[model samples]
Target: MREVAAAAGVSRQTVSRVLNDHPSIRPDTRERVLAAMAELNFRPNRAARMLTTARSRTIGVLAASASSLFGPASSLDAVENAAREAGYFVTVAHVSGPEVAAVEAALDHLMAQAVEGIVVIAPQQRVQDAMAAVSLQVPSVTLHGAGLAGDDGVFVDQVEGARLATRHLLATGHRRIAHLCGPGDWSETRARRDGFLEEIAAGGEDVTGIVSREGDWTAESGAAIGAELLADPELTAIFSSNDQMALGVLHAAREAGRRVPEDLAVVGFDDIPEAAYFAPPLTTVKQDFAELGRRCVARLVERIEGVGAVGGGGGAGSATGSATDSAAAPVPPQLVVRASA
Candidate 1:
């Protein structure tokens, strides 16, 4: 700002007024400031500006996956876009494990950065608890979290989404359906499994207990579990909790000489980009993970600005969830039908 003002032959306040688009600045002065800006390639420090206004303008993001995964990656992208639109920057931290220690480590890292707000996305119980234990000195929200309720944070409707996926298969005349569920500890996996079971019971299906296989939400795990599902003669359809596992199911079925939608139908969740390019394409449940990210950031911003209620900056005694509930809208889930099913 100093350099721009000097170059433009104006006071620093004049440059500030020009940047803020103040109506009082003359056209020539505005042009000169712009010209100085161009010459210096000067970009204002948004964080520093926000600090002057008593706002950090920086949001900290914590997720379980360091590498790319469909849900986490999409959510991260959504958060980035939304934050940029809202004039904020983001710092990301990854918790590589489902344990409390991993989550605590991630939380400590985020807090150390002095971020104005935080978003902790951990789908496992231990991780959720670890995050929950974090005293809310900074505004924070949790994504896909479980074992800790109360809309105090933001989250996706995992159970409802799984119900939609399961109901879709049943609606398509698949009675002997199987589920290849992800790791049992993950709240997402548990919610989806519960939803699938609930739907089956409601529909009066036999709810073949033996038809389900446990997977690790990975292709290899899916393929391994898929083999067991294939070995069962009565199985006619399968729903894998995630696209990776669904890919395994596809590979296993192909190796076993079964044609999708002919010998057996398959559906997966997350609807990853690659899902559409699979052997016969995968019919799956799609979660707006990006929307999840946006919502989380928005909530954090609201809390940081004191414009809305969230995390009362105390222990778990405060009721931040109730105040924010009206401000929060749950993101919906959808089904994408393709050749696989």
Candidate 2:
């Protein structure tokens, strides 16, 4: 502070005001102080600021070990970037399992860091239930798996994404459509399964019945399920819960000497980067994981700053300056059509 003040010909108090973004500082003075700080490579001490303001300027992220998944990993990156832009640091704690004990341990770790708020990437029903049971005191937001929006949460409308994928198959004249879903414990699995079933029922197809199987959201599980589905010669299309599993279905179809689109059309969720490069290319739903992450940070910061309600009163909106406004409809995932479906 002293070096920047001396270099900019201003008092230390003036430099502090500039650093804190005080509106009282003159425009020219603020510019001069910023320039001096940049030239001197001066950085504010977070510890001193915390002592003065009683704020750690840090946020906590609670997530499962599914960081290897495309959606969760991408969302984490987005949260980190948004937190940095907001002059806050992020601390992430990954729970090794879906049990309540693991969730409590992760929360305890974040609380020890004195985080101002928390964001939970909870895709499983068990994790959500655990979070609800813990009764977190700090302002918190959840990234829900189901499409239902929470007062303090944001989501990508997974049910609608599934509906889009299923409707596409129906439009293509696929009557015997089957669905390959994730584990029943995951909220995403139930929501996607419901959407697929609803759309199939809407078609009024008098086929034998709905053929569904659960997988672990992996290519291997998808391949095994796909192989089983291939035995039903009447099945015309399959909708896997995610892109990774869809890749397995593709491999199984090829191994069974089945032609894609012609013999068995397939659609998957989460248009991962590799989806387009698959053998026949993949038709999948694209979620804005980045936007979801940004919104989580923005909402949590608002709660921490007392500008938004704590817990589940309000703030189920997108971040300010985001592509969508809070008053507008929730962002919907897009279906990227390719040769596979």
| Candidate that scores best on lDDT | 2
RMSD of each: 3.9, 3.9
Taking all chains together, each candidate's TM-score versus the true structure is 0.84, 0.89
| Candidate 1 per-residue C-alpha lDDT over 1-341 given as tens digits, one digit per residue, 9 for 90 to 100 | 99999999999999989866689999998999999999999998876776665556678888875456677677778888888877777888898776667777877787777677777666666776676655656666666642235535566677777788888878887778887888776777877888788888876645553336578778999999999889988898898989999999999999999998899999899888898999899998888877777777776676676632442464323335445546665677788999998
Q: Which stretches of candidate 1 lie over 4 Å from their true place?
A: 2-11, 14-40, 46-54, 96-102, 146-151, 205-211, 307-324
Estimate candidate 2's RMSD in Å.
Answer: 3.9
Per-residue C-alpha lDDT of model 2 across residues 1-68, encoded as one tens digit per residue: 99899999999999999978899999999999999999999999988998987678888999874888
Task: Identify the runs in model 2 with alpha carbons over 4 angstroms from their true place.
Answer: 26-28, 149-152, 206-209, 307-329
Structure candidate 2, residue pairs in collision? none
State the lDDT at 140 in candidate 2.
78
What's the lDDT for all of these models?
0.77, 0.82
Query: Native-vs-model 1 lDDT?
Result: 0.77
